[model samples]
Target: MLPINRAVSRGLFAGLALKAGSSTDVAWARACYAIRFQSTSTHLTDASNRIRRRRKKPAFLDRTPFPPSPEEAVNNILYNTPNATPAPVTRHVLNCLVSNEPGVLSHVSGILAGRGFNIESLVVAKTEVPDLSRMTIVLNGQNVVIEQAKKQLEDMVPVWAVLDYTHGRIVERELLLAKVSTVPHEHLSEFVEHEIEGQEVEEPESRTSFSPLLGTALQRQAITELARLFGARVVDVSLDGVILELSAKPDRVDAFLKLLKPYGIVEAARSGAMAMPRSPVDGVFEDEASLEVEDDSGKVDATMLPPG
Candidate 1:
């Protein structure tokens, strides 16, 4: 079909030819129509070619390789370095002071979870200031990972401050409560004798009647002595078991648990570590400005920390 402009032009030219009444005029009209049609067709063809070119992919795309998958890309960037060895992971203790509000713990934990970190132990409780709370987090990670975690935690709105006491001379302690069997194990007999430092008394035939009671008394004595050596106390005593309580450093708590293992620990609970830096002087507290400066420097003043 002819375009409107072409149809109108054709009609006008034909009318002129009829008025002129000459074969030359008619042929001229036909020639002009053909020229217009050819030009239109050429213009339409060029436009269609341009559209097709625009739709085609770029030449570089054909030569360029597809991007690596997310997992592969991460591996290449983080793990595929030349002569790179894995960073050594060590335990880190981070103390965060946060506002005492609901869901604060969940928010902090969610951040760590999103970053793919596992919290070994977490202890949260109200600080001396009623409006603020202290959260102690224990985790094992490379130094870089821990530092990144600290930065992220510090960025949180509820987190007022983050203190890393892993390398600092802080007084850290954990509480352990273990329910151990009152009946002593045979293996612990030698240990008991060594710890108690008293020889057993031989009894006559008539006195042998009290042997069972004597054995029970000796067992209690052994347990009590072990507790005293570790600065623990027997908090509860029952016919079958005794609850021992110990508040000490994490390593000492572990050692105490190991010592009680032979006696059949029925149940045990340990409060995750809580820590504070030693006071520089008696009854004097370090202010927030000094704490901030220490945090920025990543070092605790040796003079501020009391020597052992």
Candidate 2:
């Protein structure tokens, strides 16, 4: 893991020192080579330190300088006491800033696959800014694996930053689009969509009057009431029934689905949890910036915006 310059100098020193010569001549030659290598290695190490100090800082919480020399990282690990036990496996969400180009994703994904890491979920999309894309990956592994993945990602020329969201406080969310075959048309409540708009799930929603003229008004009204309870909204209604959309924690979504099963679930799509580290302030969702993105296709991809 020596720097390239140091490695080259060592190789030259070894080659020069191995040459046959008279006893005195050999001693002088070895001494000269040793001195030369030392000087070269020192200069190279200093240059490496300068480069590392100038390495772009990741937006992540850690501000530690990138390793000045790869050898130093190895030495640190070799001399450091090992943890009592290998870190237990845990889920981690990693966000990587990468140049928008072909094969970058394949290169990154290949590295993890080669290392036998399991990627539970992965999302790749352009960011709000131009050219730079964000790769959000969810993996389950020990702390050591996570560290290896981050280092590997940082090594790639196209990667600008790799932030381990799980290691720090973060704002996390998941989205779900579920289609159910039942529309609570029984209750004459006009519709739940009107109520779902412009409201946070936490805030109380006043009951909209059910349309008395609608058939099965009471049943439909009850269904609308329950949908509101589960923080669901009718995104679309047609012959297939109703499309309910919601965003919440995974477990909450599970509960919501379980309750809606009697309504006949036709299909569902969920965006695996996306996360970003919280700011220095409190963990309030409002304290963080949203990650809404729109590509050249004119399609808005809402990974995780502020939940309201």
Candidate 3:
């Protein structure tokens, strides 16, 4: 068996305690668990201080809580709440093609971080050609906010293409590293609430595009009509505030954005795009598709097993 991290082992034991059996040594087990928990914290802190001491610089150490195993997490939910079902979290992956240039990564990260979205994982590698890099960013946000982020990215000068990879067709992979911070229970509720609300607001976001009008008189009239008509908040203003962004249905967004094209506009940004499959083949069709793994038989066959 692989060595279990302290957090995982401790969490498992904590879960097991809630399912105590009469034959078990409850008092002794509880006492042992408490001691182990304190010792682990102390060791971790001491190790951190030692490293800082050697370096002679103050450094903040980040510690990550171990993710619960799927079974353990399910057990925790069922045991803690006998009546409620734990809803599965929806996750999405996005593939981005961008000009391989300086500041592109920073530009992308800025857009996501500014919107309070958490990027779960990211992988960047050069594609088959020079000066082109492919990026895979895994993120968790409400469907709305993520879509908005994607649209905003597409509008960015450096981005060539952005594809959502959650659906089946493309090969998708990401690398993740995390640091944990403990927040008080009261603060946690507020933080989580803010996250939820932000997601809800971003979901219905849509954009409109318009063609430039033939004459200046008609273009000015169109802009005025749109500004007077739309009730959604203005997220962006382009073409000297003639082109506007308003949260609305897909049709409304299209009508509003399209009305601006006749005003001698060179470019416009409609930042409400979300990643979904152009077709159903974007994700796995059945269980068989997921069970397939890499062709690793040759690699494994060449290695000798250690003596038991």
Best by TM-score: 1
Q: Which digits, one per residue and each the tens of the lDDT, describe model 1 over residues 147-195? A: 9988998998999999999987689999999998765554345445543
In order, candidate lDDTs are 0.81, 0.72, 0.59
In lDDT terms, how accurate is model 2?
A: 0.72
Could you estimate the TM-score for every candidate? 0.57, 0.50, 0.30
lDDT of 3 by residue, 1-308 (tens): 22336544654575477466535566755654665666678779999999888986658876878899999999998899767564444676888999999999999999999998777666676888898998877777667677888999999998998887665544332111111122222334544565568742122133452212122234445555655685533344332234344554335656655554444344454433233333433464444444443334335643577766
lDDT of 3: 0.59
Tell me how candidate 1 scores on lDDT: 0.81
Clashing pairs in 1: none
**Candidate 3 segments exceeding 4 Å error:** 1-89, 173-308
Q: How many backbone collisions does model 2 have?
A: 12
List candidate 1 segments past 4 Å from native. 1-82, 185-213, 281-308
Q: How many clashing residue pairs appear in each of the predictions shown?
A: 0, 12, 17
TM-score of 3: 0.30
